[model samples]
Target: MFQDISCLEEIPIPDSLQPTIFIQNSLIKLVKNECVDKFCRIILESEQYKTKIIVEKLAEELVILSQIRQNRFHLISRICQNLFSESYYKEQLRPLLLRRIFRESSYYLLLCLYNDQIYSQNDIMNLILEQKRSDFAMYFAPEFGLIDTSIMIPKQWVKKVIKHLSDYQANDWALFKEYRTLGWLPNSIVAAIKKDDLDALLDFEVDSRFNINNFIEASPLEPFRLPRVNTYMSLAAIFGSINCFKLFYQSDIPVTDRIMHSAIAGGNYEIVRICARSVCDGFEAAIEYRQNEIMDWLLQNSLCKISSAVCMDWNNLLAALYLSDKTETNEILIKGMNEIYEGKAIAMPEIVSSSSNYF
Candidate 1:
């Protein structure tokens, strides 16, 4: 069953007339089970799958599996290696699987491995150059967790985004035009834009009188500055700051490397992960979106010697902790405390003291 999956991205999800009832029914039932190994069964029954959903279901299972069994991550990688390296199932499985690969902890390691493997086989920079050819078709990147497709730009909405940009650009209070233009509508920007007083807009929002679609018109403003800014760092050319993010390099500011702050402030997971060089941001983005699979992957990886920066943003951190279940909450607190002692976690004392119940 080992298929040449590296070339899988080359294959497209073909439109087929075949019905997917068997696989759909079988997998759905299997997905409902609280086991990760069932994913292997689902994979084994691949012949019955016909739609793109089997890919999603299998991915979900893999993530669940990884979260609970960090030691087995090598096995997980092998499964992935098999799917991508084989040709027989390449067209049918690879396309759907790679999209979900980043959702697994194995992906983080695999990406590093691919970098080394490709270097041995070819040139290093050439591999980085080839990345753009991957499904970065939209402004968002899955490496950042699922892109906020809700912020997607259609041809028709281009005018709406631009019109708002022109109107908001002149206002110092609305410096978020750049982020909005980049295809992101961060929740912080959403709450930050309304003038610092109770107004008709706020009223309309509370009373459900305002059009929710108006969210696309608002953007993130640079209200807060990184006092420890990376001297030569320029936010100008950071094109997808609103929707996606690049990794934080050695040039990054350790004191201000709050992954959650970067993520929810702009809602970009890539920026979040980039800062999480060692610590976990509690999977702030996925938690915000109730993306259980993504959150699971993060928690699993955090156990493997990962860490984040200081100056932790409370709003995002609290949101993540509260959104968790009993097991998740305890794990988060323990891991967070350990990181704090190790100086990997950010300090937000007031937040640590206050207890908010999350549903």
Candidate 2:
């Protein structure tokens, strides 16, 4: 019977305690077979499963067995269905189920739970707050739309996060950027930018509590003199807010090559053009980094001097050649190569020759 447990739906839970123990064992066998739905049925219907210890143990078993394969979602769905339909299970088993999901399923399953809408915002708060894992709260914030609101992050949790941000590091912001689902920051930050609230921005920048040295250290600007100035500039460029970019430009922050690169990366061609003229090595950096649109803009604006000498190096020539699919660019690199090799009998590398069409 264990060899082919597909007929488990036909099996009934025996009434006697000893026979019920046997049935529970058989249900566990089905769990090992990844018959999670059937296992859930046994839990819902079996008299043996009415015993709290037995049910909890089997629930834990189902959670573990589901993890062995790609069947956890099915189990989660069944569990969620049971929670919504059965009040006793929701009251008695919900917290245990949540604790198990948190401990065993990892955050990917947490995200799946969010996507599945199996838990409400209050349910999450109760579950997460009881654990006192503030980091989990922050990580799960976006999923709850806790930080995606138009006004601000919810004030109840905002105080908690604000307190946490007192020791914020650049890496913290980087991690937030990587994991931010809808936008770069809570809507409050975006709203501040939209309104050009420099004072509010400055407050956030110099918030006394923030151990923001990791952020300041990464910047080329002076740490004491508003290290976040270029950061704001980058943010403005990212939003394509030309006026805000100009505001940052006119501020105390010195426009560095890095800022210009940020503008190029943001596709803010106009700001890139303006900064390219004043910022050192903007053209060369653009070429090296394959910022083709910015390079083209720089060339159009008479800002580039990428001539035969510049392309003599194999790497530089390759960058120039591969930066775009335009036929003219291919011709430019080819002509530069010809000019460089005019007096030599050097042969191009096989790789270079083979990739000629890539230009």
Candidate 3:
């Protein structure tokens, strides 16, 4: 009998009967499409197909495809957990799944550690160390009491891990104390500023070694130097951590036009207001970064002056006209320029076409 089995969804499975070849091939397609509900129903409800070697091969394909896509990891975990309840599936699939997960991603490895019954704590720790995932190893080792002193943390990750530990309130933990004793910690003041951990900053201030002037007077390259207002405080503005910026501001650190440029790039209106001083470079940065709010703010606040030699350059005007996405922003820029050059009778740039209405 010639049968049309092209539409797998329409195929009806009879009770207690083996799924035909068409249904089996359709199951593979379902796995690829991540149709979890239908895949599980068909596999679990069917008597013959679930026990076949093809099911094991399908599960392996699912893991490989999910890893490559960098998503649907939860579905993979759910599939394994559901299938693992059966002794035959568990015994057949465990080693293959674990090996694939270990080779794919540290994130997936960590997920398997928490979600699967396959890995012991020691196994996870070893995998973390092998992967050089210091962030994971630092917390996991301390939490599970699996600290391996011989494992070397990369220098770049050490400070970030320290900040994470403090954020998690793990400073009092023995591992933190051990890090301090071993001189693995960066400058506490800088760490506190970067973390916005005001409490830790206060505690450090009470120490005899804590000297605010030492940080302030230190050269920019010095290890003890305070965070730069232009760099670090600008980041604080981006993150909306006004308290951290205030901390730096109250310390009487010198502010400069570079700070305004950085704040403008960050696109925080309040920081731009607080740090506003020079608009020459700030306006250029705003134009380059396409920060419309900052551009509007600069024009509205009378901060931009095209009469300034810096802004009068043809390149600056051309860039502003070409890069501005909105006609309103371009008009604002031209209006600001016109206000500055009022009564000079100097003609506007030829690049300002009538179509843009920037006259």
Model 3 reaches what TM-score against the true structure? 0.33
Tens-place lDDT per residue, model 1, 251-344, is 2434233434333233234554554554455454343333333344455565222112111342223223333446644454445544543457
lDDT of 2 by residue, 168-255 (tens): 3245455343433322334444435434566655566566763322221211111111123445565555445677677667765677
TM-score of each: 0.24, 0.33, 0.33
**Candidate 3 colliding pairs:** none
Backbone clash count for every predicted candidate, in the order shown? 14, 0, 0
- Per-residue CA lDDT of model 3 for 99-190, tens digit only, reads 55545433343444465655567656766667665554554544465355345654444455555755434554655544432222445554
What's the distance in Å from true for residue 355, model 2? 72
Off by over 4 Å in 2: 1-37, 103-105, 145-359
The superposed Cα distance between candidate 1 and the true structure at residue 139, in angstroms, equals 22
- Write out the backbone clash pairs for model 2: none
Error of 1 at 37 (Å): 7.1
Worst 10 residues of 3 by lDDT: 217-226
